[model samples]
Target: MPLGRLLLITVSLVASTGLASAQHDRADWDRQRARMVEAAIIEAGVTNQRVVSAMRATRRHEFVPLAQRRLAYQDMALPIGASQTISPPFVVAYMTEQLDPQPTDKVLEIGTGSGYQAAVLSPLVADVYTIEIVPSLGKRAAKTLSRLDYDNVHARVGDGYQGWPEAAPFDKIIVTCSPENPPPKLVEQLAEGGRMVIPLGERFQQNLCLMRKVNGELEREPLRATLFVPMTGAAEERREVLPDPERPAIVNGSFDEIADDEMEEPLPAGWHYLRQAEIDAKARPDDPAIAFKNDEPGLPSQALQGFPIDGRRVKRLRVGFAAKGEGIRFGQQASQWPYVVVSYYDERRVWLGDEVIGPLRGSFDWIERSEELPVPASAREAGLRIGLLGAVGKLWLDDVRIAPAGG
Candidate 1:
């Protein structure tokens, strides 16, 4: 062959190989993302058509760090530096569903980590106003959203506790971080009949709650149990400094009353970080007894498990349990529905038992049966157990009733 012909053949082969490689990479990425959407958002009953469409359209990989792009679509939270987290897709979908946003509504998002949640909301609602306390994150998110053509989103750097007062009377408000309670300002900013979803608790564990304003009264409901970083900035400051007493303490006695050597530096209120192990030990049971009305099929299941329990109720359930492992399975059938498994260890760290139940996909009348299993001694003195719910057309579990056996 002539030298020119040989060179052209070599170049053609190299180009073909590169094209094939790129096609394979794109295919793999698409498959992984599709699985994530099916399992986390769709199966979980995130039925808002616009929300689902926006979630599918946005490329989450672009919002994460380059090193973490591979795991972007996984059904777990991802760290976005600054000790903040981009919430798991399932959580974002769950909270979005709870808000039940309408096409013309204006939504406010607190805690704009990486701007992923805000991005998801921008395409669903008429307008999205988001606030991030960290100046750097706020600036980065604003640029990212702008580049993505999210013209309806407005990003700002400020204390989230104060909310966006200038954009008051929002149709819906969502706080990504956990607060001790819903900030009064957020409630005041809500339009009449508007809803606000927030995680309420101390620094460690928090309860997912929804508050609706009606006739100048706030109606609160505990939806589920979840964990989130505490709402930082002004909210944290407000909690630390309570009003001073009417009078100061005056000890006129000798130095014996207050020995100079007995003094030690006081511990900072926010400095006591709970280790992951301690947090797991203090974690609440996943399944608590809850009751519901109009248990419908094909709709998302409701769990009253997060309500504030009185001392008596807490004692009754033997609330403490060590989680061995938890997994979820998805399905779509006339009755046999998708469900989750919550396995636990006893106080001694031995495998204890597990519970299984159907989630709300449709109506409740179709649900048939639910089950629980206990661990066997052969399995390291701790056995594996499961809760199985039989075929039901559409069933929802509310107010999970869990108590220590023989307690």
Candidate 2:
């Protein structure tokens, strides 16, 4: 054989060997994930099958910085810069189990930290919308989640206190940071019949609160004592409202109650589909009517509407949600993107403000947003409308809620 031909053959063989070695290393990593699940997650008081399965499938080592990659599968949280640490495997599993996510559920996560929790949650639900306050951490985690093929996981950089409004209703909301109290905005964004798991209390004295919304009320159960990064931004200034473990705050702020047979449907009771005509009237004349609300429609989004906030004396009001606008092909830039809108009204059924709160930006991603409206001193009863408009895409809301600030 010619020398040149022999050399080419040798090079081809070397390339194939290198590829095989890389594949082998990947397999080893997969094995490590499984072992971690069994020892760190499954044995750590989390027995949920879906959570266990998701933990096994996700590659934790891929989420950490290169220097700390080998420690990813260990039971502890690791720093991902910006002073944030990914939740430990057991903690992630425990919080995930606390939510009791369903296959069709949409989940919202506050504190994207390393995006590791979102990755762990991706396989367990239809969507995982995460928000990280630190821009650098958000950018890095977003990159890592994408590289790892966690397409269902979406991330954004913003203050998580407001929650994600356009995604205003979530089946579950999990807060990784420790807040002095459950952020009222987060409570307002909790969907009826949904669950929110958060670390509540001051700094190191935080306790894990498993909050479930049922019959328009929040049932608070302290699962364990834990330490976490204190929630920053608006949360730092939050006046602590010590909640009664026996009589927690209620958000009965939106939707109807779910009966045993209606578990498959997204809308709970007290909620109805908003008509396109009503939505079109709100749109600018030059622009097209806001997208239709139905899963059958391409880029399908289902919109739910409820009565405005009941007449009540409240000092502060909050509205928001965890949302994703998928396939949102917008000609406008991010600043002009349509997001979740919280329209305010008065008790006499008269519309009070023309301003809407949220707008969706980009295509196919989840973003967290929130806005607080000051309760006018003269207003006796206020009304609110929570829904998505003026965006073209499949939008999702989980853990939707509406409530007075704090308790």
lDDT of 2: 0.64
Kindly report which residue stretches of model 1 are placed more than 4 angstroms away from their true locations once superposed.
1-24, 240-407
Per-model TM-score, in order, reads 0.58, 0.57
Error of 1 at 345 (Å): 22
lDDT of 2 at 396: 48
| Each candidate structure's count of clashing pairs | 39, 39
lDDT of 1 by residue, 1-407 (tens): 99999999999999999999989987787787787787568875578777787778777877886766888997656667666778878788878888888889899999987999888887778999999998887888888889988899999999899999999889999999987888888988999999998987654335577889999778887665565666888778655422111111111101111112221211111111111111111122453211122223223332211112222212222222111212322224454344444333332223335445434343323233334333233221111111213222322222223332233
lDDT scores in order:
0.59, 0.64
By summed lDDT, the worst window of 10 consecutive residues in model 2 runs over: 245-254
